[model samples]
Structure formats: structure tokens, C-alpha cells
Target: MINITLPDGSVKQVSKGSNALDLARQISEGLARNVLAAKVNGKVIDATLPLYEDAHLTLLTWNDPEGKSTMWHSSAHLMAEAIELLYPGVKFGIGPDIENGFYYDIDFCDYDISEKDFSKIEKKILELAKEKQTYQRKEVSKADALDYFSKKGDEYKLELIQDLEDGQITFYKSGQFTDLCRGPHIPNTGFIKAVKLTKVAGAYWRGDENRKQLTRIYGITFPKKKELTAYLEMLEEAKKRDHRVLGKELGLFTFSQKVGLGLPLWLPRGAVLREQLEQYLKRVQKEAGYEPVITPHIGNVNLYKTSGHYQKYGEESFKPIKTPVEGEEFFLKPMNCPHHCEIFNSSPHSYKELPIRYAEFGTVYRYEQSGELHGLTRVRGFTQDDAHIFCTPDQIKSEFNGVIDIVQQIFTAFNFNDVIIQISLRDPQHPEKYIGSDENWEKAENAIKEVAEERGLNAIVEYGEAAFYGPKMDFMVRDAIGRKWQLGTIQVDYNLPERFDLTYIGADNEKHRPVMIHRAPFGSMERFVAVLIEHCGGNFPLWLSPDQAIILPISEKYQNYAEKVLLLLKKHEIRTVIDDRSEKTGRKIRDAELKKIPYMLIVGEKEEASGSVSVRKHGEGDLGTFSIEDFAQKINSEVNKLINY
Candidate 1:
């Protein structure tokens, strides 16, 4: 018998060779029925995978993210089966479960596929799903695997098999279709009761521009019909909130082919909106004792080499610029920390000034492929609200908690209440892949976990998600439409200080390395704005709105009053605009509503004489007439409530 430990610290003695599914059956029949996968000793694997020794086991149900992933991943295989039944002689490429669902690339030699075929394809998938075929996993020798695909005329699988070692190759068979995979799939096709094929697009076989283009089919599946119905509704809502559509409609930001594919040109309105977000964070940082700094858009190649970013991310960075001096080169800066580290080195510090926080809205560049660029979110160049905190090892937990407070405040101010926290630690099995001593890595990871628990965060801890340099915490924000986006991140690093040879005087009058904490509450200005635009459906918060209020005249007769109202609002520093054109008041109101202005003020002859304006709120009806001072004060009060942090 072997002792199996569960998540809640309970242990059960079970016979060796008992798989996760058997363990689940021992616990409860319902749990066994719901188990999609299992995590064995921190590795997610098939529920049917047999255990040879004692280890920690966690049964994954549909409620867990990994469970959902396993379901979606299995759904991809089910989808392939359906496609092969409908269209034979189709060569398949890689198909992996994405954040929302899954996509499989196929080389349809003579057959053409598009969105119009989605209905029949989805129908076939559900039809096959009802057959309730179990997904059977079998290990095969590479020579046999190659022979199987060779006879089947699937070069894609043959190519994959050639790269894999002979003894480690495996194949999964579901229904009449078989594919090469190393999987933790759900038990059977019956788990997917409903399906939707969302998109059909063209993709290069291996993401190489020179490779043959293949058709990629995107799809999602659910355990119940009602769940699928709800998901389809969310997709419709997401279409209405897509950032590109909202960006164009709201006149916030734009892209120009002349400017470049992945570079965004911020319009005047978008610039004003960005400035407001920056100023709010600046105020918060100031109150928190952070010193603001500015850095250039490019840095010498050697600078990154010393910081080790060049070694890790040099390929993704833009091509280096050659100078008149021989062998002198500079790169479009791919990170902000390397420069901040230099700033810390510029001045010597004593033990009295142990913790120093440096903040910057630094722009960095990467050469993102054209296929990957999506408006401002995936731009080639963007500015990060980046900062680094240098403190002693003893200050790690307190400083991390302080930064978490700031992150929480930022989320609250932006109305992002649905927040998910992830604590990523170094992989224990592959210690050589990470920098820093084991002691420091353990201390940093434990500090994050303890702080998260103390603050009642209900965080998820994932091993091996850490950067090569350090352990980290990531904040995933769910927008208004229930779509998750990773926006804020904080990493604790012991490597950079050692790499830079950074030191400060300790209380013992000796030199010691200061641990560096990397943080960005907004992640990047461009992507954050993109997420925010979709989060609120283009209706920005009052404080962040470019035009807080617009003054409208009943007719040309009231243009003078409109101008007076605009002037008064401006005197109170309210972002107000005037619709003084020769148009009807109803037309003016309609236009202002489309612009998403928070407050609309109508000024007529009665308002000119009494110095009062008629008020109407966007998405809400009128609020009678108010004196200009009262309206401005009310608006100011609303803005104040959002920025107390």
C-alpha cells in the first residue's frame, strides 16, 4: 500500500498501481463520474494514468481551470474526428487548446473550408459525441508510429514523429480518428454535449511565412447545452465590446498603414485619456514614496547583455541599429528594468535608505509578427507603467504586500472587481534553469504565498510559471463581458542585483545585495487602455473620460449660452465641449450620447438669464435644471470618489 496525500492534508493508504480514476471511485461515485483529469505530484496527467508510488493527487472536475483545459483539449480531438469523417484525405497540423477553446490546423489538399461550413462541422461533432467513444491512449515505438502515418499519407504526423524519440512516442485514438499526442484527455466524447465552431482562418503550417498555408478551425465545447447557449451569448456580447470596433466608434485611438502594422497612433482624445490614467497612478505613487524617472527608447546592446535580457529575449527584440563607430550597436529597448538598474547605480545608498522605488512610463519595442498584431493590445511598441523597488532581503514580504495594496487599489479605481491572482514559483525538478541561490528563491516564493494567504486573496499557486530570473505574482482581470485578461504583474528578483553587482551599506557596516521587485500595475499603457475600453464598453469612468460633459444649445439662438456653460465648466477644470453647430437639440444629444460623454448640459435662453443649465446623464434620463456651480461641484465630487487612492 502507498499513502496518497490530498490537497487538504488528508492521506489515504491505497494499493500501488491505482490510477487517479480508481482513487476517485474510492472517494465517491459522483467524483469519479466528474473527474476529467488529475494532478499527480504537481503534474497534470490523464485520470487513467496509473501511479507507481505514493504522491499528492488532486482530482480535477469541470469546476477547475485545468479540468476545463482538459475538456477543451479533448474536444479538439473530437473535432478532428468529425472533420476526417466529413472530409477525408485531409492532413492535420498542430491543434492545441487555447485560452477560450481550441483550434486545429489542417491541410485540405483539394478541399476548401470556410465559415459557411461551420454549421455542418459542428453538427457532425455533436453527432460523433453522442456515440460516446472513449479516448484510448497507447504508447508506440517511433518506427511503428512513422510507419502508421507513412501508410496513412500524413506528412505532418510523420514529421512530428521523426522529431520525437522512439520510446517516448504516444498516440491517442478516438472513434475512427487517431493522432499523435501526449495528453490528459477527458474520458470520452460524451462529455462534450454541445459545440460551436467560432472561426475559420488561414494559418501557416508552422507559423513560418514561407511554409504552406493551411486552414485553421477554432471551436469550443461545453458539457451541457445550456452552458453552450450562455457561451454563445457571451460571444455576441464580446463582438459588441471588441476594442477595435469601440476604438473607432469612440474616436479614442486609431492605426495607420503608413505608420506601421503594429504601431498605434493615439488620437487627441486617446492622448487625453492616457494622460488622466498616468496622472492618477503618479499621484498614488507619490503618496507611496516612489520617485518618478524617465528613460530613453533605446539602449546599448551591452546594457542588455549585462542585465541578461539580451540573452533571454534577444531574438524577439527588433534588429539592432549600427552606429558610425565600429561594432557599436544599440537596440530598441525591449525592457525598462535594465535602465532603472543603472539609475540605482548612479547614486550610493546607506542602510538608512534601504528601500528605493523608481517608476517610469517607459516605451519598449518588439517585432511582433503581422498575424499576431491586434490593435493596441499587441502592438510592436508600447509604454509600460513600469517600476522597480530595491530593498533588503528582510523587506521582501512587506514591500510585496505594499505593492499588492497598490494593485488592489488600481483595480478598484478602474472597477475591475473580478480579479484572479496567481503565484508562480520556480520549478524544483529543474533548478539549473533558474538563477539565484535556492535559499533566495524559496524565501521569495514563500513570501508571496504567505502574503496572499494573509490578505485573503484565494490565490492559485502554479509551479514552473516563473521567469528564469525570479518567482512572481500575476493578476488576471475579468472584463465586463467575463473575458479574462492578464493586466498587472509583480516579479521578485534576486538575480538582477547580483548580475549588476549592486550593493548598499548594511547596519553591520558591510555591503549586501538588495533584492529587486519588478512591478507594473497597468502592464502597458496601450494594452491596458484596450482592455479598459472593452471592459466598460467604451463608456469610460468619469475621471478618465476625455470629455466629461458636452454643452449643447437648443438651437443657434442659444449658442451664446452654450459657450458660457462650456467656459464655466472649463473654469472648474471639467473636460467639456460645445456642440455649437446649426443643428437640432435632439441631434446634439444623440451625437453626445454616441460620444459616450458622461454628462450632457443643455443651455437655452432660460438658462442664459438664470445662469443654470438643463442636465441629462448618459444612459440615464434628465436631472432637471441646475446652477452651473452646482453641476460643476457634483461632477468634481464624482471624480474625487474614484481617485482617493
Candidate 2:
């Protein structure tokens, strides 16, 4: 008998070979039926994998994200199995689970695949799923793996095998299909009740443009048919809310060939929106005792080398610029921290002033592949709401707690109440992937976790997701349509200070190293604004709206009244605009509504007599007439409520 520790702190004495499925059955048959996978120690694995020694185990069900990922990954195998049956002699490339679903790349030698083939493929997938074929895993030697794929004439599989080590190889077989994978799959194909092949696209082999292009089939699966139906409906709604489409329709931002790809041009309205967001944060940062600073767009190449960013990210950075001063090369700044480090080095400091905070809205550049660039979300140029806090070891916790408060404050204003927090740490198995001393890493990681616990944040810990220089805390927020996005992040670093040789005189009059906290509540201005547009469907909050209200004259005779109302709104510090077009009242209102203006003030002969204006709210009918002062007061009340934080 061996000791197995369950998640609830219970120790069970079971046979050494007992699997997670067996343990779940012992607890309750219902749990066993729902168990899709299990987390053994810290790694996720199949529920059917046998235990060889004492271990810690947590059974994963459909409700868990890992469990859902396992199911989706297994569904990809099921789809491939169906394709293999329907069209023999088809070679497989790679199949992976994406954010929404699973997709498989296939090298169809002589068979043509397109959208017309999706229905039959989806039907065949459901048929194979009902057969309840068990997914089996097998550990194979490198030689055996090569021989198997070699006989099948699959160069893709052989190429993948070449990079992996001998003892780490594993293959999973489901139904009549077998593939090379390092997998934690669902128990059987029966877990998938509904299947949909969403689209067919072209993808180069291994994402290399020089390689042969293959047909990539995208798909999704659900445990219940009703869930699949709901997902399909959400997909339709998401299409309507897609940021790229909404950004263009709403005139927020755009890209041009002359301006270059992946670099967005903020239109007048979008520029105002971006400035408002920046001013909001600037106000909050000022209140938090942060000093604003600015840095140039380029930095000496040696600056990044000292901060260790160049060594880790040099390949992804643009080629360095050589100056007339030979051997003095500069690169468009890829990060702001290195320049900030030099700023700290410029002034000597003592422990009495340990926690010095500097903030900047710094623009950084990266070399992103043209294929990977989406709208503003995945851009080559972006500005970070970046800040760095240099604090003593004893002050680390309080500074971290304050950063959390800022993130919470930002979320409150945006009404983003649905947030998932994650504490990301380095992988213990791969120590070489990270920098910094073990002692410093332990201190930084402990400071973050302890602060989170003290603040009562139920943050999940994920290993192998940390930055190379430090551990980080990431905020994953769900948008209006239930899509998850990583918005804000806070990182604790001990490596950069040491690399830059930064120090402060301690209270004991001895030189000591200071801990660095790197934070960005908005992550990036472009990405945040993009998400905000999609979240509210282009109907912005009053304070952030491009045009708070538009004054429409009922007729050419009432133009004077409309102009008077607009002046009064502007005097009240409202973002007001005038619509003096020759169109009728109805056309003006319709145009204003389509522009997503928050309020429309209609001025006519009645307003000219009563000195009052009729107000119409966007997405709603008329809000009745009010004096100009009263309307401004109403707008002020709503905007003040949102900005009170």
C-alpha cells in the first residue's frame, strides 16, 4: 500500500498501481463518471495512468479548464479518425486545441477539401464518437516510433520525433486512428456528444512559409447538444462584436498599406478615446504617489544587454540601427524597464526613500509576423501603461498590495467584475529557462503568494508561465460574450537590479539591493481600447465616449438654439458636438445613434420658447425635455459615478 494525498487534505492508503479513475470510483461512482482527466503532482495526465508511488492527485471534471482542454484535444483525434476513414491515404500534420475549439492540419494528397465537405465530416465525427472507443496511451522507444511513422511515409511525424528525447516519447491511440502525441486525453470518444466543423483554411506546414501549405480544418465539440447550440449562437454574436469589424464600423482605428501593417492609425475619435484612458490612469497614479516620467523611442543596444532582455528576446526584435558613430548601435525600444533602470541609477538613494515609483506611457516596438497581426490587439507598435517600483525587501508586500489595489480600481471603473487571477511561477523542472538566484526567486515568489492570500484573492498557481526574469500575477477577464482575455499583469523581479548593479544605502549604512516590481494595469493602450470597444459593442461609457452628446437642430430656423445648447454643454466640460446638416430631424437622430453617441439633444421652436431641449439616449427612446443645465447635471451625475474610484 502507498499513501495518496487528495486535494481536500485526506490521505488514502491504496495499492501502488491504483489509477485516478479507480480512486474516483472509490469516492463516488458519479465522480468517476465525470472524471475526464487528473492532475498528478503538478502535471495534468490521463485519469487511467497508473500510479507508481505516493502522489498528490486531483480529479478533473468537465467544469475544470484543464478537463475541458483534454476533452477538446481528444475531440481533435476523433475528427481526424473520421477523416481517415472517409478519405484514406490522407497524411496528418498537427492537431491542437485552440481557445474555442480544435483544428487539425491535413496533407490531402489527391483529395480536395473545402467548406462543402464540412457537413459530412461533422456527421462522421458524431458517428465515431458514439462508438465509445477508449483512448489508449503507449510509451514507445525512439527507434520504434521512427519505424512506425517511417513505414506510414509521414515526414511530419518523423520530423517531430527528431527533436524529442528517447524515454519521453508517448503515443495515444483512439478508435481506428493512431497519432504521435504527449497527451492527457479524455477516457473515451463518448464524452463528445456534438461536433461541428467550423471552417477550412490554408496553413503552411509547421507555420514555416517556405514549407508546403496544407488544409487546416477547424472544429469544436460539446458534451451536450444544447451546449453546442448555445456555442454556435455565441459564435454568431461574437462575429457581430469582433473588434476588427466594430473598430472599422465605429471609426475607432484603422490600418493602411502606406502606414504599414500591424501599425494602427488612431482616428480623431479613437485618439480622444486613447487620451481619456491615459488621463484616467494618470490621475490614479498621481493619487498613488507615482511620479510621471518619459523616455525616448530608441535605446542603446547595450542598455538591453545589461538588462538581459536582448539575450532572451533578440530574435524577435528589429535589426539594430548603426549610427555614424561606429560600433554605437541602437534599437527601437522593445521594453521600457531597461531605460527606467538607468534612470534609477542616475540618482543615489537611501533606505529612507526606498520605495520610489516611476510611471510612463511608453511606446515599444516588436517584429511580429504579418500573418499573426490582427487589429490593434496584436500590433507591431503599442504603448504600455508601464511603471516600476523600487522598494526594499521589507516593503515588497505593501507595494504589491498597492498594485493589486490599482488593478482592482481599474476593473471597477470598467465594470469588469468577472476576473480570474493567476500566480505564474517558473517551472522547477527547467531551472535553466529562468534567471536570478534560487534564494531571490523564493523570496519574490513567496512575497507575491503571501500578499495575494492576505488580500483574500483566490488566485490559481500556474508553473512555467512566468517571465524569464521573474514570477508574475496575471488577470484574465471575460468580456461581454464570455471570451477570456489577459488584460493586466504585475511582475516581481530580482534579476534586473542585480544586472544593472543598482543599490541603496540601508538604515545600517550598508549598501543593499532593491527589489523591482514591474506592473501594467492596462497591459497596452491599443489592446485595452480594442477589448473595451468589443465589450460595450461600441457604446462607450459617458466619460470615455468620443461624443457625449450631439445637438441636432429640428429645422434651419432652430440652428441658433442648437448652437446655444452646444455652447452650454461645452462650458460644462462635456464632449458635445453639433449636427447642422440639411437632413431632417429623424435622419439626424438615426445617424447619431449609429455613431454610438450616448445622448442626443434635439433643439427646435419648442426649445427656443421654453429654453429647454429634448434628450434621446442611445439604444433607448426619448428621455423627455430638460433645461440645458439639467441635462448637463444628469450627464455629470452618471460620469461622476463611474469615475469616483
Candidate 3:
């Protein structure tokens, strides 16, 4: 007998060859029926894989992310089988499960596929799924794998096999289809009761633009038809709230081919919104004892080399700018931390001034592919609400907690109550992918974990998602339509200070390295504003709205009173504007509502003589007429209510 430790810390004595499914059955019949996969010693594997030694096992069901991945992965195979049946001689590339669903890249020789064919393809997938074909995993040698794909004339799989080791090769067979894969798949195709092919796009082989572009089919699946129906409904709602569509409709931002692709051009209204967000964060940072700083948009190549960014991300950065001086080159800054590192090195520091916070709304440029760009969310150039905190190692936890408080305050003020935190750590198998001592990495990771636990955050830990220099905590927030977006990040680094040779004088007169904490609550001004536009549906909170109130005149007779009301509201620091156009009161109200103005103050014959104004809230009906002072007080109070941090 061997010992198997369950997630709840129960040790069970079972036969050495017992599989995860057997253990699940031992636990409960209900659990066994729901088990889709298993996490064995932190590695996800097939539930049917035999376990021969003592191990830690966690049974994964539909509620677990790993289980969902396994289901989606199996769904991808179902999709591939359907595609092969629909279009013979179609060569496959990669088909992996993504955050929402699965996508397969296929080189369809002289075949055309589009969204119009989605229904037929989805029907085929469901038909195959009902066959209840078990997903059979077979280990094969590299020579045999090559022979199999070579006989099928699939050069893609042949090329993939070239880089893989012989002994570790495996293939999964489902129904009448077989594919080369190292997989932990669902038990059978029957688990995917519902299927939907979401979209069709073009992708280059291996992500290399020079290679042949293949047709990429994206899809999603569910175990229940009701769940699939609900998901489709959510997709419809998401389409209505898509940031690209809303951004254009609300005149928030735009893109111009002449200006360049992946670069966002902020219109007047969008600029105002961006400025308001910056001002709000500026006030919060000031209160948190942060000092504002500015840095150049480009830096010398050597600066990045010394900071270690050039070694890790040099190719992904914009092409270097060559100068008249021989061999002198500069790059559009890919990150702001390096410049901040140089700033810290500019002067000597003592223990009393140990923690120094530098904040910047720094604009950085990256070389994002045109196909990957999506409005302001993914852009070539964007401004980061970035800040770095330099403190002693002993102060890392408190500083992290402080940063968390700031992030929570910002989210709460913006009415983002549904926030999820993710802790990202380095992959242990690939230590060379990261920089920093093991001791420092452990300390930094532990500090973030402790702080998150102490603060009682809804946090999940993910390995192999960390930055090259450090581990990070990221915030994923759901918008009004339940579409999740990554908005905030906090990272701890012990590498940059050492690279820059930064030092601080301790109380004992000994020199010590200061630990670096990098954070960006907004991630970037462009992306945050885009998410905010979709979250509030362009009906911004009063304080953040570009035009807090609009004064409307019933006729030419009451134009003077409308102007006076606008001036009175402006004098009280409310962003007020007057619609002086000679249009009907109903037309003016409709226009103001379309513009998403928070409030509309109407002036007519009676209001002109009475020296009062009629107030109407956007999306909500009128709140009654009041004097200009009372209206200003009301607006102030409402704005305060929304902005109380």
C-alpha cells in the first residue's frame, strides 16, 4: 500500500497502482462522477493515470480551472475531428485551450471557412460528442510519432516532433480522430454536451509573419445545454458592451491608419476622461507619501542592458534609433523601472530616508503586431500609472500592504467591487528564465503571499506567470457586462537594485541593497479608461464625467437664464456647459442624454422668472427644480458620495 494525501489532508492507504479516479470513487460516488482531471503533485494529469508511489492529489471537477482546461482541450479535439470530416486534407497546427475557449490553427489547402459555417460545424462537433468516445492516451516513441504524421503528410506535426524528446512523446485518440499531443484530457467526448464555434480568423504558422497564414477556428463548449445558452446570452451582452464599439459611439477614442496602427488618438472627450482619472490617482498618491517624477520616452541601449531588460525583451522592443554618433543607439522605452532605477542611483540615501516612492505617468512604446491590437486596450504606445518603492527588505510586507490599500481604494471609488487578485511566480523547472537569487525570490514571494492573506483578498496563485526579474500580483476586474480585464499589477524585485549597484546607509553604517516594489494600479491610462467606458456604459460618475451638467433653454426667451445657470454651476467648480442651440427642449434633453451627461438643467419661461432650474438625471428621471445654489450643493454631494475613498 502507498499513502495518498488528499487536498483536505486526509491520508488514504490504497494499492500502489490505484489511479486518481479510483481514489475519487473511494471518496464519494458524486465526486467520482464529476472528476474531469487530477492535479498530482502540482502537475495536472489524466485521472486514469496510475499512481505507483505516495503522492499529493487534488481531484479536479468542472468547478476547478484545471478541470475546465481539460474539458476545453477535449473539446478542441472534438472540433478538430469535425473539421477533418468537413474538410478533408486539412493540415493542423496547434490547438490549445485559452482563457475562454479553444482555438485550432489549420492549413486548409484551397478551402475557405468563415463565421457563416459556424452552425454546421458546431452541429458536427455535438454529433461526434454524443458518440461517447473515450479519450485514449498512448505513449509513443519519437520515431513512431514521425512515421505516423509523415504517413499522413502532415509536415507541421513532423516539424513539431523534431524539437520534442523521443521518450516523452504521446498522442491522444478520440473517436475516429488522432492527434499528436501531451495532454491531460477529459475522460470522454460525452462531457461536452454543447458546442459553439465562436469565430474564424487568420494566423501565421508558429506566429511568424513570414510563414504561411492559416485559418484559425475558435470555439467554446459546455457540459449542459442550459449553460451553453447562458454563455451565448453573455456573449451577446458582451458584444453590446465591447469597448471598441462603445468607445466609438461615446467619442471616447479613435484610431487612424495615417497616424499608425496600434496607436490610439484620444479625442477631446476622451482626453478629459483620461485627465480626470490621472488627477484622482495623483491625489491618492500624494496622500500616500509618493513623490511624482518624470522620465524621457527613450533611453540609451546600454541603460536597458545594465537593467537586464535588453537581454530579455530586446527583440520585442521597437527597433533601435541610430544616432549620428558612431554605434550610438537608443530605444523607445519598453518600461519605466529602469529609468527609475537610474534616478535612485543618482543620489546617496540613509536609513532614515530608506523608503522612497517615485511615481510617473510614463509613456512607453512596444512593437505589437497589427492583428493583436484592439483599440486602446492593446496599443503600441500608452501611458503607465507606474510607481516604484525602494525600501529595506524588512519593510517589504508593510509597503506591499500599503500598495494594496491604494489599489483597493481606487477600485472602490470607481465602483469596481468585483476584483480578483492573482499571484504570479517563476517556473521552477526553468530557473534560467528568471533573474535573482533564490533567497530573494523566496522572500519576495512570501511577502506578497502573507500580505494578501492578511488583507483577506480573493487571491489565486499561478506559477510561471512572473516577470523575469520578480514575482507579481495582478488584479483582474469584471466590467458591467461581466467581461474580465486585467487592470492593476504589483511586483517585487531584488534584481534591479543589485544590477544598478544601488546602496543605502543603514543605522550601523553598513551598506545594504534596497528591495524594489513596482506597482501600477491602472496598468495604463488608455486601457483603464477603455475598461471604465465599458464598465459604466459611458454614463460616468458625476465627479469623473467630462460634462457634469448641461444647461438647456426651452426657447430663445430663456437663453440668458440658461447661461446664468451654467456660470453659477461652473463657479461652484462643477463642469457645466450650455446648449445654446435654437432647438426644442425635448430635442436638447435627448442630445444631452445621448452624450451621457450626468445631469441636465432646463430653463423655461417660468424658471427664468422664478430664478430656479429643472434638473433631470441621466438614466434616471427628474429630481425636481431647485435654486442654482441648491443644484450646485446637490451635485457636489453626489460627486462626493461616489468619490469617497
Candidate 4:
């Protein structure tokens, strides 16, 4: 018998050559039925694979993220099988599982496919899924893999195979269809009860624009029919809350081809929303003993080179600007930390002033591929709510904890209570992917891990997700609609300080390198606003709303009363706008509702005579009537309640 350790610290005595599924069956048949995959010794693999030695095991079900990913990945294979049966000789590029579901890129040569065929394809997928087909994994030599795809006229697979070594290549076959994949698939096809082919789009073969474009069919599958139905409904709701659509409808931001591809132009209303967020963060940082600083949009290329950013990210950065003076070249800043490091270097520091925090709302630019450029989320140019703390090694934990507190405050104020804290560490297998010595990397990673434990934070550790310079802790927030967004990040970096030769005189009267902590509560203003717009569905919190209240006169007769009410509300610092348009009262109210204003104040003959305003809350109409002072107090009170933290 061999000992298998479970996640809860229980040990199971199992016979040699027993698989994870056998262990699950030994525990309970019900658990074995739900088991999709297994994690052995921290590596996810097929549950049916035989275990030769004692190992740590975690039985993964649909509830576990890895289990869901494995299911979806198998579902992608199912999808490809269905498509192949329907359209003979349909060459496939790559099929992989995504965040929500899975997609397969195909070179649908000479075949016309569109959204109209989604139902047909989905029907075929469910038909194959009911067959109880088991996915068979096979290890193939590189030569064998290449010959198989080359004979099938699939250059895409052949090209992918060339990158793999003989022993490292694997292929998964299910339901008369086989493809190259490194997989931990679900046990069988019968596990998928419902299937939905969401959409189809054209994508370049490997994200290279110069490569041939293929049809990318996106899909999602669920174990139960009801879950699929609920997911479809949520998707419909998501379309209505899509930031790009709502951002334009609410007059927040826009883009133009003449201006640029990924650069966003914030309108007046959008600027106000962004400014409110900035001012709030600025106030919070000021209270936390942070000194604000400014940096130019462009910096000398050598600045990034000295900080090791250019060497790591030079290809992704915007092209350097050539100056009339030959060798002097400037590049649009891709990061704020390098410039801040230079600022820190300009001034000498002593141990007495060790923990120096510099904050900036710095705009940076990058060269995002045109195809990958999204409205605000994936943009070429955006501003980061960036700050860097330079402190002694001993103070790393306290300063790190302080930043976490600030991050929590931001999340609380924004109503992002459902947050997942992830501690990202470098991949031990690929140390060459990152800069810095192993010693510095270990110190940085350990500091973050220690801080998380001391703070009692439930953070998941992910390998190979850290920034090139250091390990990081990222906050992934699930929005109101259950979509996850990575909103905040805090990184511990000993590399940059060493690379920049930054030093401070210690209490021992000796020069020592200060550890750097890079943080951004709002990772980027554009992405945050986009997530915020969708999180609240454009109904912003009272404190963050562009216009807290709009005064709508019943007619031109009460326009003066509207102005009076607005003035009174402005006295209490309420953001109020008067809708004196020649439109009807109902029309004005409807327009304001569409704009997602928090409160609508109506001034008519009675309101004017009584020196009061009628209130109607957005999404919850009719709050009766109140005096201007009472109404102002109500708005201010609500705003204070949200921003008190």
C-alpha cells in the first residue's frame, strides 16, 4: 500500500497502480461520478492515469476551476469532432479552453459558415456528447505527429508539431476526431449535457496579422441543461451591460479611426467620472503619507534600459522617437516605475526617511496589435494609478500591508466585495524568462508570501504569472454579473533597485539598497472605468457618478425654480445639472434615467411655490418631495456613506 495525501491532510492507503478514479470510488461512488480530473503532486492530469508511487491528490469536480477548465477543454475536442463530421476535410488550427468556455480556430477552406449554422453545430455536438465517448490520450514521437498532420493536409498542426520534442508530444482523440494537445481532459463525453456555439469570428492563425485568417468558433458547454440556460440568459444581460455599447450610449468615451486605433477619447462627462476617481485616490494616498509626483509621457530609451524594462519589453513598447541630434532617442513611456526610480535617485535619502512613497497618475503607451485592441480594456495608451514605495528590507511587510489596506478601501468603496487575492510567483523551471538574481527573486517572493500569511489573507498562489521584475499579488474581483476582472496589483521588486543602483544610508552609516514595492490600486484608468461601467451596469455609485442629480423643470415656467434648486444643491457640493430643454417633463426624466443619473429633481408650480423639489430615484422612482436643503443633505449623506472609508 502507498500513502496518498488529500488536501485536508487526510492520508489514504491505496494499492500500487491504483488511479485517481479508483481512489474516488474507494471514498464514495457519488464523488467518483463527479470527478472530472485529478491534481497529483501539484500537476493536473488525467484521473485515469495510473499512480505508481505515493502522491498528493486533489479530486477535481465541476466546482473546482481546474476541473471546469478540463471539462471545457474536452468540450472543445467534442466541438471539433462535431464540426469535422458535418464538414468533411475542415482543417483545424488550435482548439483551447478560455475563461468562460472554449473555441477552436479552423481553416474552413471553401466552406461558408456563419452564426446561422450555430444551432446546427450545437445539435451535432450534443448528439456526439450523448455517445459516452471516452477521450484517449496518446504520447507520440515528433516525427509521427508531423507525418499524421502532414498527411491530413493540416499545415497548422504540422507547424505546431515542429516546436515539440519527440517525448513531449501528446495527442487527445475523442469520438472519431484527434488533435495535438497537452491535456488533462474530463473522463468522458457524457459529462457534457448541454452545448452552445456562441459566435464565430475571423482570427489570424497564431495572432500574426501576416498569417492566414481562420474561422474562430467560440462555444460553451455545461453539465446540466439548466445551467446552460441560465448562462445564456446572463450572456444576454451582459450584452446590454457591455462597456463599449454603454460607454457610447452614456456619452462617457469614444474612439475615432482618424485619431488612432486603441487610444480612447474621454468626453466631458467621462472626464468628470475619471477625475472624481483620481481625486478620491489622491485624497486617500495623501492621508496615507504618500507624496504625489508627476512624470512626462515620454522618457529617454536608456531610462528603461537602465531599469531592465527595455530589454524585457522593448518589442512590445511603442517605437522610439528619433531626435534631430543623432543618437538621442525618446520613447513613449510604457511604464511609470522607471521614471519614478530616476526621481528617487535624484535625491539622497537616509534611514530616518526610509519608507518614501511616491504616487503618480501617469499615462503610458504601448504597441498593442490592432486586432487585439479593445475599447478601453485592451488599449495602446492608458493611465495607471501608479505608486512605488522604497523602503528598508525590514519594513517591506508593514508597507506592503499598508498598500493592501488601501486596496481594500478602494474595493469596498466601489462595492467590489467579491474579490480573489492571487499571489503570483515566478516559474522555477524558467528562471531565464525573468530578470534579477535568484537571491533577489527569492527574497521578493518570500516577502509577499509572508505578508499574506501575517495578514491572514486567503490568496491563491499561481506560478509563472509574476511580472518579469518581481513577484506580485493581484486582486481579481467578480463583478455584479459574476464576471471576473483583474482590477488591482501590488508587486515586490528587489530587482529594479539593484539595477538602478538606488541606495540609502542605513542606521549603521552604511549604504544599502532599498526594496521597491510597485502598486496600482486601479491598474489602469481606462480598464477600471470599463469594468466599473459594466460592474454597476453604468449606474455608478453616488460618490462616483458623473452627475449626482439632474434638475428637470416640468416646463419652461419652472426653469427659474430648477436653477434655484440647482444652486442650493451646489452649495452642499452636489453635482447637479439643470435640464431646461424645451422638451416635456417626462421626456427629460426619461433622458436623465438613460444617462444613469442617481437622482432626478423635478420642479413644477407646486415645487416652486413651496420652495421644494420633487425627487425620483433612478431605477426606483418616487421618493416624494423635500425642501432644497433636505434634498441636498440626502444626496450628500448618501455620497458620504459610500466614501466614508
Using lDDT as the measure, which candidate wins? Answer: 4
Q: After superposition, how far is residue 316 of candidate 4 from its true place, in Å?
A: 4.5
The worst-scoring run of ten residues by lDDT in candidate 4 lies at 435-444
| lDDT (Cα) of model 3 | 0.90
lDDT agreement of model 4 with the native: 0.92
RMSD of candidate 3 to the truth, in angstroms, is 4.8
Q: What's model 3's lDDT at 381? A: 96
Q: Please list the C-alpha lDDT of all candidates, in the order they appear.
A: 0.91, 0.91, 0.90, 0.92
Better of 1 and 2 by TM-score: 2
lDDT over C-alpha atoms for residue 609 of model 3:
83
Native-to-model Cα distance after best TM-score fit, residue 212 in candidate 3, in Å: 6.6
- Cα deviation at 588, candidate 1, in Å, is 0.9
Error of 1 at 577 (Å): 0.9
Give a tens-digit lDDT track for model 1, residues 1-645: 988999999998888888899999999998898999999899999998888898998999889999999999999999999999999999999999998899999998999888999999999999999998888999999889999999999998888888898799889999999999999798888889899998989999789969999999999999989998999888788888898998888888898889888989888999999999999999888888899999899899999899888888888778899888696889998889889899999988897897899999999898898879998899998999999999988789999998998999999999999999999998888999998888888888889989999999979999889988899999999998888999999999888898888999998989989999999999999999999999999999999999999999888888877887888889999999998888888999999999899999998888988999999999896989999999999999999997764
Model 4 agreement with the true structure over 1-645: per-residue lDDT tens digits:
889999999999999999899999999999999999999999999998889899999999999999999999999999999999999998999999999899999999999999999999999999999998998999999989999999999999999999888899999999799989999899899999999888899999999989999999999999999999999899999999999999999889999999999999999889999999999999999999899999998999899889777888888777799888686889999889888999999989998997999999999999988889988999999999999999987787789889999999999999998999999999989999888778777877887899899888889999999987788999999999999999899998877898889999988999998989999999999999999999999999998888999999989998888888888888898999999899998899899998889999998999999999899999999999999989888888888899975
Best by the TM-score measure: 4
Candidate 2 C-alpha lDDT tens digits along 571-607: 9999999899999999999999999899999999888
Instruction: Give lDDT tens digits, candidate 3, residues 1-645.
Output: 889998899998889898999998998998898889999999999998999999999999989999999999989988999999999989999999999889999999988888998998999998898898888999999999999999999899999999999899999999889999999998788889888888899999999999999899999998889999999998887777777887888787899999998989888878888898999899999999999999999999999999888988898788899888797999999889999999999999997997899999999999998778887889999999999999988888899999998999999998898998999998988988888878878888889899888889889999999988899999999877777889999998888999999899999999989999999999999999888878987778889888889999888888778888878888999998889898988899999999889999988987888889999999897988898899999989988888895
The TM-score that candidate 4 achieves is 0.84
| TM-score of every candidate | 0.83, 0.83, 0.83, 0.84
Root-mean-square deviation (CA) per prediction? 5.3, 5.0, 4.8, 4.4
RMSD of 2: 5.0
